[model samples]
Target: MQTKLTRFSFIAAACLILAGCGFALRGDSSIDAKLQPIYVASDRESQELSSSLKRQFAINDVAVSKRRKEAKLIVIVKLLDEEKRSVALDREARDAEYALFESASIELQSPDGTNLRGPHTLQQRRLIVNDPDNPVGEETESTIVRAEMREQLSIRLARQVEFWSHQLQDQP
Candidate 1:
């Protein structure tokens, strides 16, 4: 019984220490009220990116307006470039590794021509190993990596918005 009590007390103390240090698990990020009702815009080539951004906003309990006119802020996202190139060659002179890069441009503005966040580039890169014996597997792995990069870029964009929102709240 004494050992059990000691163990419980230790666990409780550890929890308190972690909480005091500002350590937190990632979850919904709060946005300022001034940036509410945001609209995400994307061209046909960037539809996937827009969809992922919308998902991030939804997770944060933000409502995305269907009409641009109804939004207090507009977030425009465009795919700028994508490239896949061999980075390594095997002993047999075949491809051994590939570097994948993707970049997108983001801009935040109000409907009345106020720039909240200037145009900036968000980029993501991933290095993937290629299996010369399995061509199909290599292709599938590359595809999966690309998808993950897109999701990562979306998360970054969401964080940018959160930062802008907090900045607005701090301003006079």
Candidate 2:
């Protein structure tokens, strides 16, 4: 009985310490209420990003509007460039590894054309290994890597937007 009580006490103390230190488990990030009903404007090249952003916003309890006129905040995402460069070469000079680079510029604003947060550029890269004998496999693997990179980029962009929204709201 004494041992169980001591263990319980230790666990309770650890929980208090963690809470006091502001340690929180990973979960959906909080977004500012004022930034809800957002409009995401993207060019054809950034359609995937826009879709991902909308999904993320929904997950975070923020409303996304299909119509710009109905939104209080607007987020513009533009695909700047995409490049695939060979990073490694085989003994016979064939490409062994490649790096995929994707870059985009993002802007946060009000519906009335007020710049709220950014014209920030975000870049992401992913490495792919080429199977010299299997061209089809290499192509498929590269596509998968690019998709994964895009997903990661979207998560990062969403976090940045959320952070900025909180910061702007806190300002007097």
The lDDT per prediction is: 0.89, 0.86
**75-122, model 2: which lDDT tens digit per residue?**
998878889999999998888998999988889998998998889999
TM-score of each: 0.85, 0.83
Which candidate's TM-score is highest? Answer: 1
Indicate the worst ten consecutive residues by lDDT in candidate 1: 26-35
Q: What lDDT score is found at residue 4 in candidate 1?
A: 100
The C-alpha stretches of model 2 lying farther than 4 A from their native spots are 1-26
User: Which ranges of candidate 1 are over 4 A from the true structure?
Assistant: 1-24
Candidate 1 lDDT, 37-156, residue by residue in tens: 999999999999999999999988888899899998899999899999899999998889989999999988888758888698989999988899999998899889989999989989
